[model samples]
Target: MMKKADVGDKTKTFHKGQAIYKEGQSSGEAYIITQGAVGLYRLAGNKRVTLALLRPGQIFGEMGVITGEKRTSEALALDYTEVIVLDQTLLHTLLLKSPRPVQIITSYLVERVRALNALVPERSSSNTFASVCSVILLAWRAAARSGPKSEAAQISTVELSRTIKDILLITQTEIDEVLEKLARVHIVDIVDVKGTYYRTDPLLGTKKKSGEFVKERLLSIPDAERFARVSRNMAQDNPDANGAELEFIDLDDFARAVDAQPETILKKIAYGEVPPALFHFHKRQALAFAASKGQDYFQRAKRPRLKVEDLQNVDDVVGVDNATLEEALSRLGFYKVGVLAALAGDEARQKIYANLSKKIASVVREEVQRMPEPDPGEASDIEDELIGLIKSIKGISG
Candidate 1:
């Protein structure tokens, strides 16, 4: 029998979907699941392929510990979970002292290796294609938060097709045909960046709209009405029914949105990692589904919140005198989300004045742009404000 090695007070807790370590990360530690479940996954193109679900008492990251190699797969919490971290050096010393654990670890490694090999190419081509699509959708959703310049916005049709081809072992022509069909249905937008011919070569860059673009495209599709009806029905059947209007999309549609296989999503729902609202076999609400799962899962743990009463002095929090803090607050506005205006350079001061002036001008322009004749009084007022703003910028910069 193998004896459990004590790794010391190195236990850690993680929330659902929080990554223990990402693929390609350095691995000096293996983990013993003390409670909850962990998912082992690999990035296949943009989609996460689930390798295994590790239950409590199972050990993972052992391959890295033994081989001293970089992690090949990512480990994520399936739920609120705790694990005992075993560092490689400590584990090696323990194994040297104890023979039983080595035998047990060897057997475990062999089993896991076999399981992984079997899982790699077990699914049919169609399923593989669907999985690829789901990954693309997830990437888009992630990229959406960062605005237009994000990677999702820049993904080309060629890149997407190649990903599908690689996963499903299909020809470029077949992948293109599939994309064309998806585009016809408005599930995907095949964009030609600057009138360039869109070809299915991985190197040729193109643009595709994801996130809000996909959401809007769905509304325009003929299938959306059917999805809406299914959503309504599912809402009615839900045990946790609420009166508030909710958006719903079918599993197939949701799969299309996220570029994932419907079955993969079903598995996640079963694991309780995904909310039940997303599992209405007929319809899954895309936005709500995303919010419920994405917000809690994707969001990094926030900084420890501080209450005013918890601090002996308010200055303790900011590490500044009251006078300095007050001055900064007044200059930067109440939110203090960005840099303080008082501390900003000449360029920033100029931008602040320009922004204020432009805002004033914009309101004045909107009110008068529609007028057959410009309002002289409003135009004069706008000019005065602009001139004053310029003067303020010059004075401040000096």
Candidate 2:
């Protein structure tokens, strides 16, 4: 067990010779022995190998629970046993409530544990690629926030790793591999610098430096989006590889998935963008049934979304604060939905997403997905109306 922490009210009992949980079962909790003893074992062929016998006050299954991986070993009651179960939710709450220092240390420790338990089978490559994408994008975003945004952003590897590990259990090696891959493709440059003020110390009881530490690796990303796109192509090429996970918001794929040419998807996206497979299947079904009514039947149609610049007078709303827009939406009550609906397409959605909360964006997105395919003329009219409404707001510039 990582910490002999307080146990929640959840507990389970098993009689002597009873199996508590089998190896390869879905992992859900870290159990603290309360009474009697429990034996941890692994199976090799027909043989059952004893790993450890945990007594009262001891804990097991923390590895699987922390990594969110399946159980690697079976647990059996050596005698009548009772164990306190620290389920995932409770564990998360405990970690989340901890002080910043504790949280940071816990993150590092968790990463190490995950690395140690590498023998345990892991998740799909698509998931790893997603993580890689998130780390890179987040690192780039962090650099942008710290200073003026630039075409090439320099990010501290240590800071980036720490920040990402605090939220995700991805190991440093995984992240390094992603960056290295990006560097290989000329998407980023991993440089080593000396005498820089950035701290590169590992959190191991060392005194904090006052904005002065040696710089090990500084990541320079010329374009985060291109880096992300290349990552997508890498993941698509080898999705099951263990190295990286990428966040995918691919424009071209989305276009193809919706059964439209890239150019057609450029117009005005209708539904909330969905999973590639599911969206493709639904589009196929719709085209199959709806083709008879259309004059040109054989050509499959693609759902569309308009680029922000393509929207009528989109420049008028480009930098407007979301709160101001929300207030405007309230004023134009009838056009409020259409106002949000106009925020479609990769570039347009990026603008909205950058300035708004995900909850509000999701609400807007869900509504758009449910609406019928938008009329281009109506969409332009909605955009025009929305822009006019926004320009009327006081203290707004551009």
Candidate 3:
């Protein structure tokens, strides 16, 4: 018989301006906002952008625990906030037994996948144009929120190009051509500053100020028309996309919503496995690999990509015993260790390599302490060389 695990109840409170979790920190707990509001934000360039606000009865900080990844963003209290914490054990137990929890998780995952799939450009030129236009409109609306009062929103072309590239799997040339088309149509005014910037007036022209400029242009554009049709199809399959509110995420990011390994998921698709229903492609392969097994295989084949110590930090928050945490973490996926070796002078990068060396030594000591083994002289030398290289780079950068 399997034993039921004991997960203690833990509730925490935070004052306004206090961080519930910092970006890059390890997390194994999901928090439900019980009182006041919580702010969800991520670093945008050099600034912090509030992605969303969680009010009473809303949930936050669940992604990290579910995906077994470090925090991708920071969460702070917008005001005084109280949260009920559900540790990993409890969450896994609920996942196995509760339909409600599964449904909530599925909803979030499906929503994210749909958003990602929609960004994939259709082969038709018109459809590609529509994707670009839709992206521009989205950026324009974002700029409007920043209090631009001249009826025209100033959008940095470089930033807009980056946004389009991030959201859609498109090349720079495609994006540039789309911008040129919009400029020719008088829909967007291209201005040169330090970089190319675009000024788009949502209420441009009109003999009557009918407030239909945007709608009319969208209706007339072959690409925009195709985009709306595609959006309708997406809505039919994903109930979350049926309404006015929509959130977009990159294809890689969709994996985080479902607690799956991002690279593993991408690899499955790359190898011609059947994607989920939210994807536009029909399931063509009956014997396709499963995501769970794929992740397990990937981990075994790869070197440590992220810091193992950071993973251990997550276990600390969950209150898992050291032995158990080590055993569990030892089996998880890691990125290739030497991939970052070429990068120089980053403090964070240096610390990661240093920590990797320490973790390697600690694991070897624990596994061989009671057994007769050869001296670790060769392994120690390798660690020393790696550490020395990092220190040299740091010295130069400093």
Best by TM-score: 1
Stretches > 4 Å off in candidate 2: 1-130, 196-214, 241-398
Q: What is the TM-score of each candidate against the true structure?
A: 0.39, 0.32, 0.29
Ranked candidates (lDDT, high to low):
2, 3, 1
Per-candidate RMSD, Å: 19.9, 21.5, 21.5
Q: Model 1, residue 7: displacement in angstroms?
A: 3.5
lDDT of 2 by residue, 1-398 (tens): 43445556677899999988888999898888989999886643212445578899897887677678888788999999998888888777777887999888877987785564453333323256555565567557556655775555687888778755543456889777777777788977778876534344576756554564455778877776687678778866645433322323345445656777764454333333443443322244357567756856546754333333333544334445667666655655333453455545555556654554566667666666676767778777666776666665644344
Q: Which candidate has the top score in lDDT?
A: 2
Question: Mind giving the per-residue lDDT tens digits that candidate 1 earns over 1-398?
Answer: 22345666588999998999998888899888988999887654323456689998898998777777788888999999998888888778767777897678776875687577446443322243344344345334433544564334435555555545544445767556545545664655554434223345456565553323221111112233443344334334433211111123345567767989876775455334587544432123356566677777656643343333332221122323334333333333221212222222333333433333455434433433344443456444433433333334334321
Q: Candidate 2 overall Cα lDDT vs. reference?
A: 0.63
Q: Arrange candidates by TM-score, highest first: which order?
A: 1, 2, 3
Candidate 2 worst ten-residue window by lDDT: 241-250
- TM-score between model 2 and native: 0.32
Which stretches of candidate 1 lie above 4 Å from their native place?
A: 1-5, 97-126, 129-163, 170-352, 355-398
True-structure lDDT of candidate 1:
0.52
Number of clashes found in candidate 1: 6
Global local distance difference test of model 3: 0.52
